[model samples]
Target: MRVIKVVFLFLLIIGVLVLSFLRPDDYLWLSFILALFSIVFLLIRFERRKMEARELVLLAILASIAAVGRIPFASIPSVQPTTFVIMMSGYVFGAESGFIIGSVAALASNMILGQGPWTLWQMVAWGLVGYSAGLMQKTKLMNTTWGRIIFGIIWGFLFGWIMNIWGLFAFTQGGNAVNMKSLLTYFAGSALFDSMHALSNVFFLIVFGNNWLKILTRFKRKYGLLE
Candidate 1:
């Protein structure tokens, strides 16, 4: 199952890379279709593993917390606690669990907030944040205070950049594909939102990161879940 997840993950990256370069103008729906399939496939693989009841329960709790956590921040533009919570989940649990939690959080939150083509991109971006945070746990990046701080800051911008792909695709105003000028202008306009995202990440990660990790780690250890 791990092998399958890794293999599919590799393929997913390659798919993104290919479409990024090729970007067949008329074939945009294909990206969403592929993403939907990939997400579904990942979930199926997760389920097929005969996930423990406790693990499922834990995933649910985390996803719900991440989702509901975003609601109160709606008035603050891009500032939100969702990424902070999801990133911690990934950091302690490992990549697959992080991705699942991140993706589910996006989906669940949008149910209250509203959904659109953008939701899928958010699911992917947030999932990647958690997924990468989990992967970083094995590296020196997660070892020190500054390193983790840097991680949160970087993903703040990265999460915005990921969503920008959808913006470019959808808001190009019939340009059909992104051009250098439109892309630059769109990104420039979004800079404030992205900056807000990155700064908010640093704030939450710096202030609440350690405690959240300790609490989550304690729960994991007590339950012997995600082992």
Candidate 2:
């Protein structure tokens, strides 16, 4: 099952990239559908595995916390605690839980902020962020404070880049084929916002990341959840 999931994810990534370059217009809906399908499939697989109820409840609470974390930062453009929360969850839990939290947090928050096509992209991008963090949870790089800070900084830009794809498709040339010029222009335009996001992530990770991870780890240990 794990192998199948990996293969499917790889294929999905390839498909999205191909569609983005070849048919940027169509890529919007297609990528959205693919992401939705992937989430559903993962949920189904998780259910089939009979995940523990305690774990499910823990994930729900963590996801809710992550979603709510975005609300307090509404005044600050391009800055939010959602990424830090999700990353910390991924750091403590496994990849599947991290992905679930990231995806769910985006959807939950959008319910209040209003939803559009961009919501799907946000879901996938944030989901990948958590998923990647979880995959590296035990690695030497993730084991160190500076390494985790570096990871957060990189993901900040990566999230922005992924979100920019949607902007390019939606606002540029009325959804035309993606080209070098449009891609460059879109990124250049959003560079400042992305930089702010990256810096904010680094700040949060440096200040609170270890403490958050410790708290979550304690909770997990106390409850015997996600073991």
Candidate 3:
């Protein structure tokens, strides 16, 4: 299981790197295919382990909540609870399941928000947020309030940076090579939204952190899932 996990994660990383160079209007579709396959393949391996229907339903519910959480905040720019929810899900469930929920949430939300090449990056970004949190499940960072707040704050900017990759590719057309000024400028332009996202993450974590943790932890214990 660990070996398979490494392999698919490698593929996903390669996909992201490839996207940096590929034209979003042209070849990003290929990167999306790569990421999609990684997710499905990893999920297939996970499901083959004599998993229960309850586990599947739990995952689906988490993904749905994350997706729906994005809608009400759609009018508020970068202030949304989706990232916080996905991060919490990953933190409680462990890495692979966290990745699954994050990826599914992105795909589900984009179905309503409208999908494009950008959706792939959103999956990558949010999935990483969850995966990283799960990786810290055994660490002090995942245990302390300040540490969890820091985690949320960091991912807020990261999620924005990941999405910005799509923006860089999509707008830089006409066969023009991407340059440093363009990269810096693009990121600078998005600083406000990213900061808002980061702040919102902190806000959500402060308000809902303990309660959400208890709820998920209770579910995990009661269902005997993801243990």
Candidate 4:
């Protein structure tokens, strides 16, 4: 059941991407609605019992800060590490909260900047980052500092790869336009930004990952989240 659900979710996201190409102009609004709907539905379904209203508010505010941070300092060509850091909301909060924060941040930031198909990509891409991070947080290996550093680096690079691929597919003019030359150019252009982003992830993880985890664990204990 879990595997089926994951596959279905992937297919749903891909279907949206496919639809975006077919109706490029309408993709933003559609993406916004879908992302919001998913966030709200997930929130109601998962966190209603675990978190209070205040924590939920905190999650949104954190995501908003993250979204704003990305807009002014978007990764030069593609891939934004700041975006991945925001996705760490899942690690701090929970999967549902992380997803909501990521999705809402993307939607809200895009609205401020004027929505486009890229907004849709941003929403899905960042949301995936948070979701993946949240999932990693669940794994036993994520308990130690080295584990987090490794995970952060791996996921940061993953975000870079995913964003670059999304750019190729989402912005490419027809399938033929994404040739080796263009792909290499795009990859090279994006590499520097991704490097910085990945470095930032590593730095941030080293500096504050344990502290944030402690805070979350403390909060969970106080709030009886485990119960």
Candidate 5:
């Protein structure tokens, strides 16, 4: 059921993009409206309604870090600190917070580079990464540093696949089939970079996640959040 929802949501976004291409003057507004509503609805449904001021501030900081990490955008596949930070934040915070942070990071970063549909796709991709990271909370695996390292590898592959899909959309504009060569190149380049990013995330998690969790727990206790 969850998978179905994800598929439908993805297709809906693709449909909106197609509509934008066919009639940018008329459908662009429609696309924007749909995207806005979708994001709002998702945030409300999947996340806590009354997030604390401190959490919001942390989210903003994570987004800013992500944005800044994307400097020198033309470098193809490189080590992206934003991905690690956002994923870790989401794992520690919550899925909703993670999604917001990742999306904001992508959107803000692209503003510095330039704006386009690519930005939107990247935002969606990173947001999903954070969202999925949150699901790890359900499993007891997320409680341990080794578990996070394993999850980070999985996260890296997942991010690489999503980014490759986004690259196909951006490069081919959905006109041609994503050929093997392109797929291979994307995986070889992006997977390598993402794996490194994931390893870095593992290191960060080992070094900082427990301490951050302790701090957030204290804050939560003070505010009576999640008991």
Candidate 6:
């Protein structure tokens, strides 16, 4: 069952990428929405099987904290602590918890900021960041403060890059397939904003990364969650 879920997720990502390029312009939004919901459904199903009641509640609280972390940074474009919270949650809990927190935080924040197709992309991108962090939790790289800071920097850029895909497709000329030129142009236009995000992520991680991890880890131990 686990293998099947993993295969499904892999194929879903491939399918979404292929369809994004191949699907007709008129149907692009619809296709993306469908794909987004499909992925969410699968993730929820997978999580439901492994998570207990207490774990679910804890996930909700952490996700709320992550989402709320973005509020104070609203004045500063492209800068927020959402990523730090998600990464710390993943580092302390596990990949599944990270994925849930990332997904939930995106949804929750968008609810206040406004929702659209872009929300889906943000959820997936952030979720991937958290998931990757969780996967690296046991490694020496994630175990060190410097390594964690470096990881934050990498993910900040990566998240921006992934989110930029929505811009690429949204602005493409009707019926024109997204190409290298369009992709590069989009990325170039958003380079500054992405850089700010990357820098802010590094700042947050450097300043608060260890403290956040310790708090979450201590809480996890106290409650025996996700053990």
Query: Which ten-residue region of model 6 has the weakest summed lDDT?
Result: 26-35
Candidates in order: C-alpha RMSD to true structure: 4.1, 3.5, 2.7, 3.2, 4.4, 3.7
Which is the leading candidate under TM-score?
A: 3
Clashing pairs in 6: none
Higher-lDDT candidate of 2 and 5: 2
Candidates sorted on TM-score, descending: 3, 2, 1, 6, 4, 5
- CA deviation > 4 Å runs, candidate 1: 1-4, 10-50, 174-177
Task: Compare the candidates by lDDT and give the number of the best one.
Answer: 3
* lDDT of predicted model 4: 0.68
lDDT of 3: 0.82
TM-score of each: 0.83, 0.84, 0.88, 0.81, 0.72, 0.83
Clashing residue pairs in all predictions, respectively, total 0, 0, 0, 0, 0, 0
Candidate 6 residue lDDT tens string, 1-227: 65575576556656665555555443336444543554474356556566567776888898899999898898998899999889988888877567768877887787798766566667777777777788799999999998988898888889888878766776676327688887788889888888888889889988888788888888889988876
List where candidate 2 sits over 4 angstroms from the true fold: 10-49
Cα displacement (Å) at residue 123, model 2? 0.3
> Cα lDDT of model 5 overall?
0.65
Clashing pairs in model 1, backbone N/Cα/C closer than 3 A = none
Lowest lDDT sum, 10 consecutive residues, model 4, at 75-84
Better of 3 and 5 by lDDT: 3
Kindly indicate the candidate among 1 and 5 with the higher TM-score. Answer: 1
Q: lDDT (CA) for every model shown?
A: 0.79, 0.79, 0.82, 0.68, 0.65, 0.76
**lDDT per residue as tens, model 3, 12-91:** 66666565455455444644564476457446656657777888899889989999999998999999999999899999
In model 5, the Cα lDDT at residue 64 comes to 92
Tell me the tens digit of each residue's lDDT in model 1 across 119-174: 66777788888888987887998867778889988888899888887778676654
lDDT score, candidate 3, position 77: 91
